[model samples]
Target: MNIQELLVTGTRLLKEKEIPTPRLDSEVLLANRLSKDRVYFLSHGDERVLPEVERSFLQDIQRRSRLEPVAYITGKKEFMGLELEVDPHVLIPRPDTEILVEAAMDMLKEKTGFVHVLDIGTGSGAIAISLTRYLPQVKVTAVDIDPHALKTAKKNADKMGVADRIQFVWSDCFQNVEGIFDAIVSNPPYIDREEMKGLDANVVEFEPVKALYGGEDGLDFYREIARQAPGHLKKGGSSSLRSGVPRPRRSEGSWKKSVLDP
Candidate 1:
């Protein structure tokens, strides 16, 4: 089949399965298989896909029909303009987390000398790597509870050429992290048990549960971070945390909360 035919067939299959963003998913999957940009389809509609390519494309469509995320299928996701590797072992980077990264950047941008950052639950190293890439004075220590997630994050750091700037550690929410930092950033799991049940199959089924569940209520990680952050943050240091709330809130106590928008 040709480019247009393949996309139409894929779209139809996804629609039948009730997958959201059927057409876009089809285009993205086909583009990934062809290693060509989506724009290529506009001018090359009649171009025939190779037999192996057609088979692989159809397989990807089947995976999507089963509700697998396109990022997981492609094994790649773009965050803060950097293409990072992704898999089932790590949570796929989302656009919402960019707000957290921007907030951290704002906190560190004004600092003069070398600035240290601690990234808790740094799955895929999206938060850690982006900071070092965008801020020349920043170096990050990224920690995660899952070793597999750490491996994936480490590979992404290497892929983005920021491995030297990030130190990957196996820790569960600062259990193994030491030293004070100028800034602490995290897009920790904030979905409570109830919300987890309501998440789409595309998310609940494909993404790692350890990266999504935030205990009985969505504020478990937030509470823990707030409690321990003061001990690790430098005097007047800031924390940029992602919460499941509607608006950002500032902490009135020892540490400041950059509780960003949901």
Candidate 2:
């Protein structure tokens, strides 16, 4: 079938399956399969898709019909304007987490000399690598409990040309980490256990559970970060916890404010 006809059928199928942004998602998946840009598909609607390419597109459509995320199928997601490889091993980077990156950049820009940053639960290395890319002089130490996630993050860092600036470590939280950092930023797992049951099957069943669950109250990781961050953060430096109100916890030593995500 021609591009236009395939897109129409795909959209209808996606909508019937209750997939959000049916038309857009269908086009993107098709464009990726064709190894062409979305605009190319739009401008060449009359062009015919080869038999093999058409079969691939149909397969993707079947997956989408099951509410699977397009990023997982394509094996990539764009973050901070950089394409990063993604899979079931790591949580797909979200736009909300971009706020964390912006907050980190602001703090890093004000400091002079060497600045060290640590990204806890550095899935896909999106947070750590993006910070390193923006702050060339800054050194980043990213830690993840999962070795598979670290492997994926390293690959993304290498692809984004910031592999040298960032260090990937396999550690559960701050157990194996050393050295002080000017800033410690993390978009750690904050979703409560009960909330897990309500999440879409594609996310709850497919995405990494370790990267999503934050324990009973959804504050386990935050509590750990608060307790250990003072030892790692440089004197007067900041550590932003991406969560709600500040939970009461003992401060380690010197760090400044610990702002919560609003």
Candidate 3:
């Protein structure tokens, strides 16, 4: 079908499936598939899509209709202007996460020396990669419990050119991580059972549960991180936990500040 016709049909299908931002979603999926800018569709409105490409594109649309994330379908996501590879085994990096990274940077900006950082549950290695990218003087060790997620994070680190700087460790919280860090940063799963039920169908159905649900009280990871931060951090080092407060609603990515010095 032609560009206009394909977009119209795809948008209609997604709208019927109750997908939010149907037009934007259709545009991104098609453009990313074709390796063209979103504006390409408007410029080539009458151009026809190949039958095979159309089939693939339509399959992606159907997946989104089922509430599967667009980032997972595309296998890529942008965080802090860095394009990182992603998959279902890891959670897609969110914009709010950049805040935590920025917070860490702000605190470390004036060190005038090398520092060690620990990134917990380092899915896709966004935070670790960003820190290493911007702070060449510093070294990072990223830890994740899931083997699959750690593999995904390592792949991203390699692609982002910081694989050598990050040490990937398989650890449940801090059970296996060793040594002291200048700071500990983590965005662990913090959803309770009640919060899980209210998450968007996309998150609840498609995202990994262990990466989202904290425990019965949602503060399980926080408490665990808090319990371990002291033993693992150097003097003046603090743990930054990405707050999962205000439940699973739209305003969810806000950081809840917790300062612990050891």
Per residue, candidate 3 scores C-alpha lDDT tens digits across 142-162 of 988889989988998898888
Question: Candidate 1 or 3, higher lDDT?
Answer: 1
C-alpha TM-scores of all predictions: 0.94, 0.92, 0.92
- Separately for all candidates shown, the number of backbone clashes (residues 3 or more apart, or on different chains) is 0, 0, 0
Poorest 10 consecutive residues of model 2 by lDDT?
A: 247-256
Alpha-carbon lDDT of model 3: 0.85
- Least accurate 10 contiguous residues by lDDT in model 3: 250-259
TM-score of 1: 0.94
RMSD of 3: 3.6
The positional error of residue 160 in candidate 2, measured at the CA in angstroms, is 0.8
As for candidate 2, its clashing pairs are none
Q: In angstroms, give how far residue 117 of model 3 lies from its true place.
A: 0.3
Local accuracy of candidate 1 as per-residue lDDT tens digits, 37-119: 89999999999999999999999999999989999999999999999999998999889899989988987998999999999
lDDT for each candidate structure? 0.88, 0.85, 0.85
Model 2 segments more than 4 A misplaced: 244-262
Tens-digit lDDT track for model 2 on 132-212? 888887889999998999999999999989999898998899999999988999988877777877888889877998888
